[model samples]
Target: MRLSELSRRSGVATATVKFYLREGLLPPGRRITATQAEYDERHLRRLRLVRALIQVGGVSVASAREVLAALDDDSLDQNERLGTAVCALPHGKPADADDPAMETARRRAEQLLELLDWGYDPATGATIPAYGMLVTAIAALERLGYPCTVADLEPYARTLGRLAVNDLDLVERYGGTADEQVEAAVALTVLYEPVLLALRRLAEAEESRRRFGRK
Candidate 1:
């Protein structure tokens, strides 16, 4: 496909595709002439992934480049690649390590993982940011006088763990190449996170209406 066809098929502008090609987010097409290049299905797939990362996932160009690098590296196993992608994402502000509330929350996070028998290591680059976010949220709640105990969080954790299992099962069953699988995992998370949050809000509203309807 020519640049125009590639742009039309991928729903990305030609200029934007050229930008991606220059940025190394999308690989260059085969050189057919001094001024003409031929793209293929791989280019289309990569272009779509780049667009999703920037436009939908809210990832910066540098971060997206890093993610693409991780995805393309054949040496990294699935877990490492996924970790690299997750770590490349933006995260909440890091709480002060010395803050007493943050300390408490960190301990609680550890306890919760242990109680659930989850194998995540907070020391890992990938898991640390998420664990840090969890601690920050817990600390914030405690400071606001709504502290959640381990017991209170257990049910939510269990439910999410089950959902995660199902999520991974579906990903495995989708049956793509290693790179494609990684792309699918990242795309699914980026695209569906907002949808899941919206649905949860709707569910909360319905439950609230059920419990506290006006007379």
Candidate 2:
């Protein structure tokens, strides 16, 4: 397809696609004429993946490019995948031992994880980085004695689990005959906490509007 068509179909503007090309995130298309290039299905697939990582996963452009490159690498092993998952989490410098806020969040994370039975091992079965992040955040809260209890987190966890099941079902609707779709969904699900965070913000905004009787 032409660049314009690729842009339209991908829901990304032509200029944005060009920016991706310039950044080496999207490979150059086949030259068809002096002013035209043809992008194939692979480009479309990759562009969608790129958007998901950036817009959904909240990864920086540089980090997303790096992770995409690693995903495309056929030689990547399980360890590489696990590392990628870790970096995709909400990252920051290591918390200082004296930082009270950070300490509280870490403790709350651990407490909730224990209550939720969320194992923190990255080498385990069906590892989900979002779960790790949530646990970590709860741990931090606990350290501050923020008064979060398992009962408080349980409703949230059940809601998230329902959303996850729905999201997985939606993936199947995309016709997963290809292995890449399955892989993408698996990776996406494992790293989906960012998306969940976005949803929570949206819901909170809407709820605030309703409470104030705003249209």
Tell me the tens digit of each residue's lDDT in model 1 across 1-215.
Answer: 99999999998888998999999999989999999999998898888888888898889999899888888888899988987787777665777566778888888988999888888665762256777788888898887889899999999999988877877777788887877778778777677778789999999999999999785
lDDT of 2 by residue, 47-108 (tens): 88778777776778887776666665556664465356445544544444556555655555
TM-score of each: 0.91, 0.64
Task: Give the lowest summed-lDDT range of ten residues in model 1.
Answer: 120-129
lDDT of model 2, residue 18: 97
In model 1, how large is the Cα lDDT of residue 91? 66
Compared to the true structure, candidate 2 yields what TM-score? 0.64
Model 1, residue 164: displacement in angstroms? 1.5
Quick one: how many clashes does candidate 2 have? 16
> What does candidate 1 score on TM?
0.91
Each model's lDDT comes to 0.84, 0.68
Error in Å for residue 43 of model 1 = 1.7
